[model samples]
Target: MMGLILLPQHVLHSVVHAAMGVLVFWCCTVLGRSQYQGLAIPCSPEPSPGATIPAMCVNERYLFLLLTGGFMGYTYSLRYFLHNMNCLSFPSVQQFKYLQFRQTVPKLLKLSCVQSLYLTRNFAAVYFFLGYIPRKWIQSVLNLQMDQHLPPLDTVRGLLDLSLFYQIWLSGVFLLTTWYIVWLLFQIYTTEVSRMDVMDGIRWCSYRGLLWTDLM
Candidate 1:
């Protein structure tokens, strides 16, 4: 009665978001500085090239913090989808398990599929910002320190750091690809296969790409 009123999907979504919020906050608090070490602005007065603001005055902490927050949040969404799939594939209970497989699992799987595709859309946005915003700012700062003396080509090269862009793109792609793979695995588990064997849990973990090293 109350369960129908409350809506399990809403509850699960809220719990996932709340849990990820804490995780992202902790990651930003602990690992932010190290992550942005390459772009750290030293305390020095320097006339930046074609720059209005001083080089030393620009703060980039907020940029890295935002990136970390977004990255962790979407990453958690993928993990949540995988967790739901694993739970759905677990060996059946003596009685209620069949009921859940018939009734609850489909609802949860549908919700998870939506969550995964929705979260995957954020990959481009996150990667774009990481490339065009934070990296751009770092380049501008570096150019400012150079005092516009460098050639146009060199300046352009400095500003458009392909390596950083590629790294961010790779990370985003990794998360998105993982979600798709897991989503497919869950789809197969639910539709193509009906029964969960004793080895199902282990097989599910393998499908999730949980390697021996990861378990260790």
Candidate 2:
């Protein structure tokens, strides 16, 4: 009966992870294109007599939107993964007994540690790439002036300075903390159940009961 219940949940988890992987892959591709091809604005040809100048390309804006969307998608997927894992419950004592009681606590702890490292690295990357370096590069490469008065460089700098990165960083941190709490809950659950097993010898009793019931 536990197997019947757990099988579907495990299958659903696999499906969700697979879908997220695909989404991440697609976002990487789009980001690559936006980085290489989209950021370069072509020089406009000189206008003939009375000819109107072509509108400037807004490629940077488009790239910002794409990257923001990607970050949001990845964050949501991570949140869903943690949420589902945390909510899983053993329906009966038999199901709980079958859980790899001794190993579950260690496994959950290891997974939590790994997840924390990954998220920290991701946050650091965002902080460096988006928050610090890109802004500096935009100011330098675009030759932006720090003056309050309107200037062409300042206008260009404003166009390039989409704060999507900071927004995404805040959101990612929120989700990561939420997931961390979920992992903590799983750890607590495992520890409590393991201690209970020591007190009750639940696994051996459950197995013996199952054998006799099956024989009848």
Candidate 3:
């Protein structure tokens, strides 16, 4: 019997890389242009500092995209962790079976405590990124004018513009910070923590975070 494999967390690892590629392309190429429009496009196609990336300083938006992409990648990891936590049934130990594991049927499904904790953090991100950071980014458009001396900065409808372009990036960033919490909770009471040393589905080596792979 085989349920969905969730451990060693390699299933959507490709998604993590794909998201990175898409983020960079969208931010730096497709929407990227010669002129800066308030929020409709965050950065220019230019890789060099001459690109005049906005957000008060040149190339600032590029920094934001990289940070945002990194956070998004980590968030995907959280989703993978949560999937493993919910799946209680061990169906097939295919991952470790071929690896010469002592037990042919290692934990096919794993519901570890650390994964549960990650799930909680993911839910919290819904509020942190979309709800809070968006408002902050929107407000920053107004605040930015005061700091930077660029003549166009004063005239652009920065408020309305952000929703179209730059806010989209912030939304992703909200995805990252939230998809990104890692800390150990010490429960003096009963602790419901379990870990799978080997995964059933993982193939082709992956560095699923230490917090996930390491036993709690």
What are the models' TM-scores? 0.31, 0.28, 0.27
Residues 35-132, candidate 1: write the lDDT tens digits: 33433454354556787865542233334333544654545654655456435444434334345446655555555455534543464345444544
Residues 71-186 of candidate 2: C-alpha lDDT, one tens digit per residue: 44454454554566545554334334335444355664555445544653464456445543544465467654222332221233543343433433343344344444555556
Give the top-scoring candidate (TM-score).
1
Model 1, residue 169: what's the lDDT?
A: 40
Q: Which stretches of candidate 3 lie over 4 Å from their true place?
A: 1-56, 85-147, 150-161, 164-216
Candidates' lDDT values, in order?
A: 0.46, 0.45, 0.38
* Model 3 lDDT tens row, 36-87: 3233332233246665655433333333334444444555555545555323
Query: By descending lDDT, how would the candidates be arranged?
Result: 1, 2, 3
Pairs of residues at least 3 apart in sequence or in different chains that clash in candidate 2:
none
Which residues of candidate 1, in runs, are more than 4 Å off? 1-159, 194-216
Task: Give the lDDT of residue 49 in candidate 1.
Answer: 75
Q: For candidate 3, what is the TM-score?
A: 0.27
Greater lDDT among 1 and 3 belongs to 1
Specify the highest-lDDT model's number: 1
Collision pairs in model 1 = 48-144, 49-144
